[model samples]
Target: MTVTRFAPSPNGPLHLGHAFSAIVAHDRAARDGGEFLLRIEDIDGVRSRDELADEFRADLAWLDLEYRDVTPQSQRIERYRSAADDLLAMGLLYPCTCTRAEVASAAVAVGPDGPLYPGTCLRRGPTPGLDVAWRLDMEQAVDLAGPLEWTDERRGAQRATPAMFGDVVLWRKDAPASYHLAATLDDAADGVTCVTRGIDLFRATHVHRLLQHLLGLPVPVWHHHAVLVEADGRKLAKRRDAPALADRRRAGEDGRSVAAELRAALFDTGISLSDIINQQT
Candidate 1:
């Protein structure tokens, strides 16, 4: 059975991009006679708000995006920590103490998630209570995983190239687990068979593929659907101040209508839910 999921962080209200990704995943699962699950990625430390997570659930309910189960990353810290421990034991991780400004000043290249972290702390041994982050030793991890590839419904076969992002962090200084660690662990735990999200995350999948291989977890097919963007071509994101879906709902727009409009916008681009399941970007 194809188990798909729409995992959204609870740091902000839902927006059109969230709606689109949720609807696509929900529809694909329904069409394939599979299970659709909702996950609250609330592992952003204290920045995660329960009220916003509740609002996210309400927004999905309003859109009629039902699911079989709901899981929260905050509730699975132990699992993530366990995975990190396993990697650390394998000598595939190292402590990183580089600050953002320091990394930006030293980074040789910038990728989708901002400046790729330079390996400043690569040689630093894990210390006791130094307020350091844990980062995957990308070169070592890739060597351990060997040659690997993953499938994407939109982008076809993809070679795992985690080194492109440098040593990506598995644990953040302020969060229980970084998005990379928490998300990869949760997806495996939930038995997700198909991973669906906006195309902006397409690159991150390379790192995830490496994690899956290193952790000996099941690899799932991915679908990187087109992201909703503004007239200026900037993708809709909370940090960018994209209008919240709840605001539209409060303004008396019928929830279903708004959802339909979002769906229609995708359809107008010649991509339907079925196409998402079978086509490439």
Candidate 2:
């Protein structure tokens, strides 16, 4: 009964990186006799395009990676809102109006984005109108466990220090719910007991772990695989990414060769082109 999902943001075309993650997700589900689901993480309406969304579906279908159900995050904003409100009522959420500059100026800095919040807004008064992005109070999660631990099937146990990720955003200024909140809701609602995705998201495990504790939801067993890196050792991004299924489809390229290349790059497993050809079902 290991329900899993491949939740990709339909904001761009599927590339080699996406192919690795998708295969791992689908393969793990099949191995476990679990239900697999597809979730469209289209929360960013301004950037999410129908064509790109269609590309995600068409590409996955071409790879023969179909799911039992699909849930779009945009369609589930209310659920995120409700969850956020509940956290607010419990005095475990806060609204900080500090801009990127102001937060970065403080001695409490983590990365280029800003510092690990110095609790500047935590006790900054009556908890403002939430006019800006809202952050879940991390103090509630500090006692949950030591750092965060999850055994990625491909990479084994990987953990992140708590001090590294502090008070991550859950709701944006205009947008009600951000990816963190929506994704947490999706996993629980859809009964996702496990998650198999790219190792590129290893840092995301910290944010996701925090959300699970904050919302009182089950944290699934995570499996983050190594990504398909380019020859230059650079990671692929949706913007200007290559090996896009759309381009291949447009060029009238179909079938096995591409899958073989993808499989080879992903695991270094010398799968024959014929293996991919036969997998087309």
Top candidate, metric TM-score: 1
The 10-residue segment with the lowest total lDDT in model 1: 272-281
In candidate 1, how many Å is residue 97 off? 1.5
lDDT of 1 by residue, 191-245 (tens): 9999998777888999999999899999999988887766556677799877788
Q: Which residue runs does candidate 2 get wrong by more than 4 Å?
A: 111-114, 144-151, 155-161, 268-281
Clash pairs, model 2 backbone: 109-115, 110-115
Candidate 2 structure quality by residue, lDDT tens digits, 1-281: 87878888766777766776787787778887887788888877677776677777777777777677566887888889899898888776788787777767874557423576666777775456757778777767565444666555566776644446677777887676876678778888888888877666667776777667667788788887766655556666777556677776677666345555555555633333333334543
Q: In model 1, what is the error at residue 233, expressed in angstroms?
A: 1.0
Model 2 lDDT, full chain set: 0.70
User: Which parts of model 1 are misplaced by more than 4 Å?
Assistant: 124-126, 267-281
